[model samples]
Target: MDLIRRLFTAALVAGVLSGTAASVVQQATTVPLILEAEKYEVVTPPPATAAPTTTAPAASHAEGHQHGPVREVGEGVPVTLDEAMQRIGLTIAANLIAGVAYALLLAAAILLAGRPVDARRGLVWGMGGFVAVSLAPSFGLAPELPGMAGAELELRQLWWLSAAAGAGVGIAALAFARNRLVIAVAILAAALPHLIGAPHPESAEGAVPAELAARFVTASLGSAALFWAILGSVCGWLMSGVVEPAESRPALRVQPGAR
Candidate 1:
């Protein structure tokens, strides 16, 4: 039993370590591409000029007409590819730590309650954690798309698809592993938000009246929920091996008249 426990712990630790490494590698590869794109062009506005004076009456009349207030579009802060990549890496690391902590807490709770938790249940719990954590940001902030307008914003479709794929993978992994009830519950809990739907920014005040915006918001939320649920499930599964299952006693048979 002690050996088994140690083995499980080792496996969980290894899996988490590998995942962290992979995340680092991914950031390293993508950051350069992003930087190259940003460096391709630099836009500089022309110098300011004084208003030309009109000589003719007709010219004076046209020049004197007042125009509506010009909306001042502020220049956005420039983030180099390396900086963006570093930020992403940091975010991933933070989330990974949080996920692992949550998984450990859940495991401890189940053990304290004298319940036998398996890999499957751990995954479910992970998913639930994902949903719970993601909710605050999803509703509180508006979606922003810099450098994208009209059809270009369709790039969001990729995000949705990726999310769906992640959820599907999580479900499949659980089914294959045949995890326990608790894990199943966690997975479902994590997935509920995506299925329940997200608050649309289009419904918020000051949004443009485009039909796609509403759909985009809804789909994006749904997709993200799915993706995170799967991700959490996988992480939980990896960590589940670390927790020891409660021992079951063998049934005793009494011989006739034996005390």
Candidate 2:
């Protein structure tokens, strides 16, 4: 019971701190690249019409600002400082929640393993999370910028989930399962997702420039990596501090009263 309480406490603390760190890293790296990608989306030329004009369509000032809403905000978002602040706050909150969720998963896994949890092992688990969630799915989907056209949302989501599940299960089996046959099954489970292939659009549309898209993908992946690292390290450190000593302490024996 004491261990469980400490586990929860550690997870909460780790989640909040790691999530804040992720947000800061995102703001510094990913956010700038996304903003740049948006610029390209704004500038993309409209597809040619079947009506077939001998001359190019006249570009207007409005064309330069393609978003149909406030120039300072996303389409349909109001241009208000308060709204912006609210959005920022919400994003940070979401990040914190995600951090907590991952931390909980890591904590549970460690407990199940019945092994000593420390910063190093926690970090390994964090890398597993990254591989399962980010790296695996990316092989198929890569990353996309706003306004980029791609596969149907449902199909893409399904594929991404499959990939994550496969990789995660495979990694777990490989690490934990003692039987060779079980490990082989795990390997197959992991490979199956990639073999099925990622869903693709009927046609690739490049609304954002290729270079910008590439940069954004790299930055996004980097941010995720950093987030996982911090979360794993913090949780591991805290959990170890609480659990290890308690586990190793010798049991106390009471002697007969000598009143």
| lDDT over C-alpha atoms for residue 15 of model 2 | 88
The per-model lDDT (C-alpha) reads 0.46, 0.79
The clash count for each model shown is 7, 0
Q: Report the Cα lDDT for residue 134, model 2.
A: 89
Candidate 1 positional error at 10, Å: 7.9
Model 1 regions lying over 4 Å from their true place = 1-74, 135-247, 251-259
Predicted candidate 1 versus true structure: per-residue lDDT over 1-259, tens digit per residue: 8634643453355335534644554344433333333333234444335986547987656544543233233433468889776878785776456434544544443344343345566556545544444433344332432321223334344434434444544444454445676557646644654565543434333222334344445544453454345444554455443544545545577999998
207: Cα error in model 1, Å: 8.1
- The residue ranges of model 2 lying beyond 4 angstroms of the native Cα positions read 42-80, 241-259
* Model 2 lDDT-worst window of ten: 69-78
How far off is residue 131 in model 1, in Å? 4.3
State how far residue 144 of model 1 sits from its true place (Å).
8.8
Give the top-scoring candidate (TM-score): 2
